[model samples]
Target: MAKVLVLYYSAFGHIETLANAVAEGARGAGAEVDVKRVPEPPRPAHHAQAGQSAPVAEIGDLASYDAIIVGTGTRFGRMSGPMASFLDQGGGLWAKGALNGKVGAAFTSTGTQHGGQETTLFSIITNLLHFGMVIVGLDYGFQGQMTTSEIVGGAPYGATTIAGGDGSRQPSAIELDGARYQGRRVAEVAQKLHG
Candidate 1:
C-alpha cells in the first residue's frame, strides 16, 4: 500500500477539519494514511497544538511516506511559522534526496476570501520542490472550485478554505470536498509512482 502522511498546523480548527477530509479521501483511495500535527513552540503552552489530539510529527519520519499532504492556516499569505520551521528542519532529507520522486501537496485556510491562499500553497509547494518531491494539487477534476454560485475556496495550487475575519467561519462543504479530491489525487499519483 502507498504510505501517505497528512501533516498540518491548524489554529481555530479550520485546517484540522480540512485535514481530516483529506485523510478520508486518501484512505478511500487505498492509501495507508497517518495524520499528524506540527510541534508547538516551547514557551506557549496554550496554543492550538497543545490541545490537538493528533500526535506530533517527527521530522525524520517524513522520509518514509510515499506521499505527504500538508495543511496550514495562512500567515500573511504564507504558511504558518510552525509549519515553515518544521519543513526547514528537513535539510538532512534534502541533502540525501530522500524525498525525491515522492508525492507532495499543500492546502491552507485564510481569514478572508482574498487572503493569500494561493500564495500560501505556493510557499509550501516551493519547499516540496526543493526536496525534489513531485507535486500534486487540487486539479480541475474537483469542479467545486470553479463554481461562482457560492463562496468556495480552492485553487489549482491546492485545496483551501476561507475562515471569516474573526475566524468564525468553518470550511464549507465544497471546500472539504476539494480537500478530499486533492488528497485522493495525491494518493493516486503516489500509487502510480511506487507500484
Candidate 2:
C-alpha cells in the first residue's frame, strides 16, 4: 500500500480537523496514513495551541511518504509562520531531491472568505514544486465548490474553510467533503505513480 502523510499547523484546530478528514479519506483509498503536526514557534504567553495531539513531524519524514498533504491556516494572506519555518528547514532534502516524484497537495483555512486561501495553498504548493513533487489540487470534479446557497470553502486550487473573524466557525459538511475528496485523489494518484 502507498504511504500518505497529513502534515499540518493549525492555530485554532480548524486545519487539524480537516487533516484528520484527509487522513481518513486516504486510508479509505487503501493508503497507510500518518497525521502529524508541525512544531509551533515561540509565541506570547497567551494563545496556546489547544488539543493539538499529533506527534510533531520531522523534516526527514517527508521523504518516506508516497504522498504528502500539507495543511495550515492563512496568516496575513499567506502561509502561517510556523509551517513556513518548518518547511524552510528542508534545504538538504530539496538539494537531494528527496521529495521528487512524490504526490503533493495542500489544504488551508482562513478567517474570512477573501483572506487569501488560494494564495496560501499556492505558497505550500510552490514549496512542493521546488522539491519536484507532483502537485494535485481540488479539481472541479468535486462540484461542492460551485454551490451558491450557502457559505462554503473549496477551490480549484485546494480545499479550504472559513474560520470566522474570532475563529468560532468550524468546517461545514461540504468543506469536509472537499477535503476528503482531495485526500483520496492524492492517494489514488500516488498509488498509480508509486505502485
Candidate 3:
C-alpha cells in the first residue's frame, strides 16, 4: 500500500479540520496515512481557545512516504511562518533529493474570500517542486469549483477554505469535499507511481 503523509499547520483548527478530511480521503484510497501538524510557535491563549491538540510532525526522512499533502494558513499571501519554518528545515532532504518522485499536494485556509489562498498553496507547491516531487491538485473536475450559489474555495491549484475575516466561518461541506478529492487523487497517483 502507498504511504501518505498529511502535514499541516493550523492556528485555530480550520486547517486541522481540512487536514483530517484529506487523511480520510487518502485512507479511503487504500493508502496508509499519517496526519501530522508542523510545529508552530507557542500560542497559549490560542491553544486554550482551540481546546484541542494535534500530532506534531517530526522533521526527518521524508523520502519514505509515497505522497505528501501540505496544508497551511495564509500570511500576507504566503504560507504561515511556522509552516515555512518547518519546511525550511527540510534543506537537508532537498540536498539529498530524498523526496524525489513523491506525489505532492497542497491546501490552505484564508481569513477572507481573497485572502491569498491560492498564493499560499502555490508557495507550498513551489517547495514541493524544489524537492522534485510530482505535483497533484484539485482540478475543475471536482465540481466544487463550479459552485456559484455560495462562496467556496477549491481551484486547479488545490483545495482551500475561507475562514472569514474574524476567523469564525468554518469550511463548508463543499470545501471539505474538494479537499477529500485532492487527497484521494494524490493517493491514487502515488499508488500508481509506486507500482
Candidate 4:
C-alpha cells in the first residue's frame, strides 16, 4: 500500500482539525496515512527575548513513505515557525535527495477570508521544491463542490481553509473535499510512480 504522511503543527487546534480532514481524504483515496504533529519547543520565560522558534517533533526516515503532505496555520501570511522549524530539520534528508521523486503537497488554515491561505500553502510548497519532490495541487475540475459553497479551500494550488475571522468556524464542506482530493491525488501519483 502507498503511504502518505500528513504532518503539521497547530497552535489553537484549527490546523490540527484540518490535518485530520486531509488524512480522511487520503484514506478515502486508498492510501495509508500517517498523521504526525510537530512538537512545540519550550516556551521562553515571559521576560525572554522575542523571535524564538518553537520546539518540534523529531521526524523519522521519510524513505519509507511514498509521499508527504505538510500542514500549518497561517502566521504573518506564512507557515508557522514550528512547522518551518520542522522542515528545517529535514535538511539532512534534503541534502541526500531522500525526498526526491516522491509526491508532495501542502495545506493551511487561515483565520479570515484574506488571511493569506494561498500564500501559506505556497510557502510550504517552496520548501518541498528544494527537497526535489513532485508538487501536486487540487485541480479545478474536481466534482465535489456543492456540498459547501462560497469557500475557496478547493484550490488548484492545494487544500485550504478560511476558518473565518474569529477563527471559530469549522472546516467548510468544500475545504474538506479539497483536502481529501489532494490526499487521494497524492496517493494515486505515488502508486503510479512506485507500481
Q: What is the C-alpha lDDT of each candidate?
A: 0.93, 0.92, 0.89, 0.77
Name the lDDT of candidate 4.
0.77
**Which candidate achieves the best TM-score against the true structure?**
2
What are the models' TM-scores?
A: 0.96, 0.97, 0.95, 0.86
lDDT accuracy of residue 24 in candidate 1 = 94
Ranking by lDDT: 1, 2, 3, 4
What's each prediction's clash count? 0, 0, 0, 5
RMSD of each: 1.4, 1.1, 1.6, 4.8
Q: Return the TM-score for candidate 4, rounded to 2 decimals.
A: 0.86
Per-residue lDDT of candidate 4, residues 1-195 (tens digit): 789888877766666777788788888878898887786657722232233233334665566688998888888899988788778889888888889999899988887878887899899999999999999887765665333546555456787887776667878776777787888888888888865
- Judge candidate 1 at residue 128 and give its lDDT: 96
Candidate 3 residue 106 C-alpha distance from true site, Å = 0.3
- Candidate 2 per-residue lDDT over residues 37-145, each given as its tens digit: 9987878113546767899999999989999999999988889999999999989999998999999999999989999999999999999999999999999999999
Task: Residues 40-147, candidate 3: write the lDDT tens digits.
Answer: 577532542354465787779467799999998898999988888898999889988889999999999998999898899999999999989999999877997889
Pairs clashing in candidate 3? none
Q: Cα lDDT of model 1 overall?
A: 0.93
Worst 10 residues of 1 by lDDT: 41-50
Model 1 misses residue 73 by how many Å?
0.6
